[model samples]
Target: MMALFRNLFAAALFVGILAAFEPLNYKDCKSTFKINSVKADGCPQENGKCVFKQSTFKINSVRADGCPQENGKCVFKRGTNPTIKISFIPDRDLPKLKASVRSKISGGSTFTTFSLNNDNACEHGIECPLKAGQTYEYTQSVEIVNTYPVVDDVQVNWVLSDEDDSNKKEICIVFLAKITE
Candidate 1:
């Protein structure tokens, strides 16, 4: 009888330790915005000052970093429900394109397999948003993939027409990356 109780206590203790070490869910995101502008003959001058034209872009689809730590492994949730979103609004008037974005992407850093679509507003397609305005969103489908967590970063580029010249602007959308089981 005493041995049976001891075995049960030991098993409980082992389970408790395992539970304490379980992976946790952690999320973080950062957004950087930039604008590119060009004028026809030259920037529009107001009061003899130059006013540059602009086209701005929005970044979206933020993911989390998959690193092992105290809070993360502890609070890690089971499924992917709430994904991070990124947004942008041009300070001026012009056309904007979302070229490309990478998340926890590796040498196979290709997101072509993901469900990416065009935003109603512009021509660029890489990191295009679901809406035409500035706000855009991409969701991380956490499921069997969480078996091995990872940290990810989302980078994007947009093209701006400066007069007859075409220029590109860059932006970064960072997230809390996690790859775990």
Candidate 2:
């Protein structure tokens, strides 16, 4: 009876501690894009096809980790949901937009894609299909794995594309993140 009572008390204490420290949310993480730079024009090619015109969205900045890091590298803690903030200018409204993140480890790679809209069910409250000629900030949240495949550098590639026709890419951003234990 005494052992049972002690075990119950310990379990209660653990639950209380977990409740006190709320799980990391989207608002907690940061972006990693460069700041204060004029948006550049470029034609991105995917699968050997490139668009003739410049990208509709001009990337202004991407905030990740604590501060703005070069080459899109950011720092993040394990077991936390890291939010990436990207700012850009929409030269034109996109009827359909597709955003994806590709994470590459030593032996394998995985990609997760989402379409911005009300039904996307995004955890960070990101809505898609931006307005034309308007500047907007977008946030992407992802769960940082806590264990396995730990490396000094991880390549994170973010891509935005138009789905109206031919699925032309709008922007491609890459960042290296150091995941701390």
For each of the candidates, the C-alpha root-mean-square deviation to the true structure, in angstroms, is 18.4, 13.5
Q: Write the per-residue lDDT of candidate 1 for residues 45-164, one digit (tens) a residue.
A: 222221111223433222222222332121123343222222344333433443332333334454422223443224332243223344432222223234334433221211222222
Error of 1 at 28 (Å): 14
Q: Model 2, range 34-115, lDDT digits (tens) per residue?
A: 1211211121112221111223356555444332232333545677665555555556666655566666653556653322
Candidate 2 Cα outliers beyond 4 Å, as residue runs: 1-56, 65-72, 106-129, 164-166
- List the candidates' TM-scores in order: 0.29, 0.53
Local accuracy by lDDT, each model: 0.29, 0.45
Whose TM-score is greatest here?
2
lDDT of 2 at 121: 18
